[model samples]
Target: MQARQLTLDVTLPDGSDFDAFHAGANGLALDSLRALARGEGERQLYLYGEPGSGKTHLLQAACHEASLWGRRAAYLPAFLLRQGGAHALEGLDQLDLVCLDGISALVGCVETETGLFNLINASRCRDTRLVLADTHAPRALSAALPDLGSRLVWGPVFQLQPLDDAGKRAVLVERARRRGFDLPGEVGEFLLRTCARDLATLMVQLERLEQASLRDQRRVTLPFARAVLGEGG
Candidate 1:
């Protein structure tokens, strides 16, 4: 049998390339998802974290990993799939992994609420692993479905705490390395000190710096970061 070639246009926030993804602190989270892919113990995994805490990144990484393993993985943001009604659950049984982002968006709405419940049940019946990402913990979900709430607690739940300043700096430096931009330690520190602490914001700034560096045909330096940031070299 010929091997299947995987293809996807996975969109990263702010048009960042795949190399720019930072998975340093998310190693354990990835391992948990890998266990799910192997059909180990749990059928459901909940990833919870504050905004900008890399939950979505971890979810995307799981999807990417599953594809590399030649497994069928479907990634759907709950908010986007909810627009299609229950039919969205169709063919979900054929997948090995189902990754849902923004799962908390289904709270309160009767149709979406029921749709998510059905998805979970359908995936469970077929032994499919469900990876769900939400802004808050499952116990904090405001959905009206008691069974869904209870089922969420049945599996391994991981809460991703926000990265500390040092962690964030390491992430930035590592990302810069992958992007082929040699960011000096001092420059990385300068950006972290002056720019927003949020990863999303830092990613945006990094992209801007990438462009500015390319335009000037110079390596990323403290002066370049300061100049692009309008901080005046």
Candidate 2:
């Protein structure tokens, strides 16, 4: 399926790449994904982690990197295609890389499950790399399609670890720099303490702060960031 035919915004978001990802202890997983982006990989990879562990981030990042090298890459989130059914999986194997996010959401959809299995088989046939992510381990996910559920672990499954204090701060600083704002270590720490610690929420807050800083011609100091983010800081 060509991306242009869908209303869904599957394009890689800004600030999603290896440079923006805080790999933390998941450096090996990051390296593996980079290899897949270049069409030099183990053919299939499954990574599962808790919510907000950057699984989706890494998937989109992989797609972005693959596209940079002139390979056709697609980012498909199961939730967004719930109503579209198996049609979303069509023609995806023609791409060099396919990153499927939120695979757990497809457990109940028989058609989608079969479509995903076909996608996996097609990837193997075409030597295209497939990266799939979910919130549960391969065994934890219950699906009507036994073959699909049991085969999720056919490839390596990496459990992504959460970022530590320093890593979180680095992520914040890097994101701020991308938005043309300076985020001092102390201020980054402050935001971490006072706001939602999830990188996804932090990214939303960062966008708000960027707009606020530009409007007021102010630096992203502790007080300014706090004001922009309000009590969340």
Candidate 3:
């Protein structure tokens, strides 16, 4: 399909783009999502990993890239999608790319399974690319519908790896730079040692530090961060 944008109601979380992601050892997963965003590789992809492994970030990042490429895309979590019943999936194939996160939430729901099964079939007749992510691998997801389980594995499956200590430090520094400040190595180390290490939590802590530093007109020094973030730092 030709690259073209369409105005849609879906909203991605702020800073949820490819550049904000720290690849660490997930280069293959990241590259696959990039290709999918460009409409150039496998039309279906499955990503699974533990909490804080960046599955949701990568899914949103793919949508961000797809939009920048002028392709129509949507991101929907299966929990919310299930709440809307099977009809929620209607006409998803009309979009260039569709990202479904938290798919394991639909495991026991017959209606959602039926909807997704049909959507998968419809996607085959259109140019729609589907990216599904969850904490459990497809084989591990005891899908009530056998056919639906098989369909989930119809494309490449990648297990996203969590970032190491060095990677997390890199993420904090890079994100700080993007926000127009410097995150000193000592400050980063202090945050890592004190705050939640998960990227999501770390990003939130970074936001807090950024706002505090801007308000106080102070740099992000270790002492300043400790003061801003309190004893947690």
Candidate 4:
């Protein structure tokens, strides 16, 4: 796999990309997703993990990289599917890469299943790559369609694990850098202790800090973090 540069932002919303994601102990998942983006590995990839394990981020990263590499790519999250109708899957199967997040959300929805099953079949015909991310493993998911359950494991599966504290710090710092600022280790530690400790919450903290810093023309120092975040800090 190519070396990852953690501060480089992709064109995707919220700067989602391989470069901005902290793989931590989930390096295998990182490598596999990068391979998927490059169309160099298994045609289908299944990723399952706990809520803050960065599943959606990786899926978005895959789509971002795929699009950058000139491959047609789409990321289907639950709300989008609910809004667009799973029939939208029909229009996406022709893309070079498709990532379906929150596959667990389709548990009792037969129409969604029908659309996705057909999407799977059509994608296979066109050699379109597929990546699926959910909180449960394929067999563990209480899917309404047995064939869909069977098909999910036809390729490699990776269980993405949550990052440790060190990993979280690195990720937050990198995220800050991508937003055009530096995050000191002490400032990051303060945020970790003063705000929500989860990576997702920490990320939200970083976003808020970035906006505050830009508006105030202040650097991301310990005092700035304290002043901007106030009670939260």
Per-structure clash totals for the candidates: 0, 1, 0, 0
Candidate number achieving the greatest lDDT relative to the actual structure: 3
Q: Of the candidates shown, which would achieve the greatest TM-score relative to the real structure?
A: 3
**Poorest lDDT segment (10 consecutive residues) of candidate 1:** 1-10
**lDDT digits (tens) for residues 97-161 of candidate 3:** 98988987667878878888988888877979999999999999887886998899889999998
What lDDT does model 1 reach?
A: 0.72
What Cα-based lDDT does every candidate model obtain?
A: 0.72, 0.81, 0.86, 0.80
Tens digits of lDDT, candidate 4, 82-163: 6656655656666788888877666668887877777778877888899988889888977787698878887899998888
Give the local distance difference test score of model 4.
Answer: 0.80
Q: Write the per-residue lDDT of candidate 2 for residues 50-105, one digit (tens) a residue.
A: 88898998998898888789887878886765756677778878778888888876
Model 3 residue 229 distance off true place after TM-score fit, in angstroms: 1.7
- Sorted on TM-score, best first, the list reads 3, 2, 4, 1
Q: Could you tell me which 10 consecutive residues in candidate 4 have the lowest summed lDDT?
A: 1-10
TM-score of 2: 0.92
Question: lDDT score, residue 75, model 2?
Answer: 83
Judge candidate 2 at residue 174 and give its lDDT. 87
Better of 1 and 3 by lDDT: 3
Clashing pairs in 2: 1-90
